[model samples]
Target: MAIRNPMYCGKIFIEKYKDEDCHLVKGLHEPLITETMYYEVQDILDGKKRKSKLTIMSPSMLPLRGFLNCNRCNRVLCGSASKGRGNYYYYYHCSSKCGYRKKAEEINKAFVDELKLYILNDESKEFFKTAIMDAYIDATKGETKDKTNWIVEITELGNRITKARELLLTGDLDGSDYKTIKTESEHRIAVLEAKLSEAPVVAVSPAEVERLLDKAIVKLTQIDVIYSNHDTYVQREVIGSMYPEKFTFENLQHRTANVDFLFQLIYQINSTLREKKRRASDRKTCLPIVAPEAGLEPATL
Candidate 1:
């Protein structure tokens, strides 16, 4: 539950010292967990994680309780399922004088309706997709070379480590000297191996990105289905990821500025061009559908 416990890092501090001097070096001891995992735990503990919005444990009901803020006073609205007659109802209640109140169903529907604005038309979808993939490919162009270099470095380090160990066993190297060299060599090998392992992110393929984007858009188009079909956990995850803060609902609509990136881009692009297209084909669904100009499609959204 706590990430601040440095005990997980495999080393203790030199007490009575300030700043980096207290924990300046690592001890020659085994680690319970990796530095990466330890930092991840720290991020969760520090509330600085990108996923901080969804850090709260999901409740059985009233998933939107902590996600909604009162529009009037800008305070978190508490929600609970209350039994009225033979069924239960959920509501978001204001904490202060605003006395703001809203039913969960209506609020959720409003949010979904707002999300629909971000779905791109077929043409715009193609434009935005190409742009996204092109950017990704450009970014990863150097990863292949980096991976190859890391592999070569790891091989060299491994051979050197083996030679050092041989020298130690043959009495050519003192025990202390062998230990220091081996530790440094092994650490370097580990670091390079890690780099090689992470060179090109496994999920950076264009097909995977497109598929995920399509799925997200499909859900936006069918928000009611998505919300009703999923469990409370999935529902909360979807909402939390879409909006990182407790958005206020005012006069019936959720005042959400933190819509999904793709959705926001689609909405902005379409707003700039007021033209609409007929539903030509199922394959050309969502986003603005416009004819290609000058043999080039406009890369929008």
Candidate 2:
């Protein structure tokens, strides 16, 4: 019987021969793409693409994944793949029954490109930096005062422990009562100490802020490529970190998401670009801003 396709032959070989028995079938017929290429494609399908030697450690891979949402089923979008004709296509699909697929490479590249554009733009960079700093400041507000209160409470707890010990020694309190009070005081002190240690430090310096921004930008820049290399669990983690909501794609062209804050940021930037184009159009016409209802206002008065 004549074999029609090399893939069909490979499938037959896989089904008929075990790994150790593959050598027995080497001379059976001429192979397709060589055994090495076939195996390479299989490895890629199995999600084992080799990494480069120059790769450095990065923390941004999963940090922003949480924020992406499905635009169709409203469920969180998940990474998926399909193999056809010896090639694999990677993409994100809705968690529910709604069929929405965006090629992984395209979406990742688009996200990274947008992030790079944002980072390179002075106004966008400044806005992002300011937002991050404002969030940090807001989170730490009253922390110092809270720490001071805890310190006072810790001291009082220590004093209470000493008083309980004294009472037990003087036979005014029973042994069990003394132990209970001491344990409670120590637990309180321990909790206060932990909280005090966790309190945020003073305002970070501009140099430190810049360093943070640089790191964030680098991670954001590398997310697409890194995610393309990672496995499903890692991809899910990455997506979950960046966007906690779901991404939905309905009818392939129309997409909507509940990510208000992120959508707002993107919309604002897009609007700014559109406004620039509009201004250029207006300059070509040399038209001035028109006042509204100037002639009719006196009639109403």
Candidate 3:
């Protein structure tokens, strides 16, 4: 704790040694770290920057272990392999005494079948493509506006720094005040520049967006095939992306899962169209309206 403290940078403690009360004394036992480096370390210590969670490796054979819940007790189902007659059999069973269990092969095959349900039909595909493209354009518009604002703020900070220097030279501002102004402005400029760098600089052309959407649609349509081909690790990731909540398995069938927003949209659009096509009604069968211009709002079915 003391190594990266302000004292390492030749800061002299005053009174109770509070941060704001400290003084920077030069030629004090040779500075160990730069001022910026000390503050950066302090930020980490203060948790201004978050640490990524440690990932524990799951067994390859039990991809669905943590994702499936016991239907009776609602506890997570654990997977294990049992040996009988010199052969191994894997099963996903309840953690409690519910005695609920299913063959891993059975549940795995059922999950693949579930993925097939999300495959987009031709009509649904056209709707999804149009809607998604419009949404992407609107999102890019917001990002572009944000980038413009950041650039303006950065320019304004630079102007402030220049003005502060001029004031310092004219004796209108004291050295401490001028230094404070420059330091704060430079910090703000750095933050804004970082944001600007992350924001998209060039607008994606409609043709490029269409190409990306084509690839996305291909993957979406072949979700089952893609998932089937993935290793257990990737397959679990695919499941997690599709279904955020753990689902229950009872009577050899998967219970309803609250899927990701995009998949919910896909299921709604595809199922609704299919249902409308099957039903005979005097009213015109209009497709569900999707307002892509609405920012971050789910499409209305």
Which structure among the candidates has the greatest lDDT? 3
Off by over 4 Å in 3: 1-61, 140-209, 250-255, 279-301
Off by over 4 Å in 2: 1-122, 145-207, 218-241, 258-285, 288-301
Backbone clash numbers for all candidates listed: 5, 32, 0
Tens digits of per-residue lDDT for model 2 on 1-301? 2333235334343344455544323445555556566666556566798733673332333222334467655566666567979987767656677776677666665554443332224335455556667666676667867988999999999999898889998999999999999888899899999988887776776568768877775655456665667765665555555444544333212323333353345446546866888999989888645545567565332
lDDT of 3 by residue, 1-301 (tens): 5655567876765554655664555545777887787777777778897655677655666778888888888889989999999998899998787899988888877777777878776789988998788887887878778888988999899999999999999999999999999999999999998887786566667689899889888888878777778787788888899887888765226437678877888888898988887775524555545545655886554
The per-model lDDT (C-alpha) reads 0.70, 0.59, 0.80
How displaced is residue 137 in candidate 2, in Å? 2.2
State the TM-score for model 2.
0.37
User: Which ten residues in a row are the worst by lDDT in model 3?
Assistant: 282-291
lDDT ranking, best first: 3, 1, 2
> Highest TM-score: which candidate?
3
The TM-scores, one per candidate, come to 0.46, 0.37, 0.52
> How does model 1 fare in lDDT?
0.70
**Residue pairs that clash (backbone atoms under 3 angstroms), model 1:** 120-286, 120-287, 121-286, 121-287, 121-288
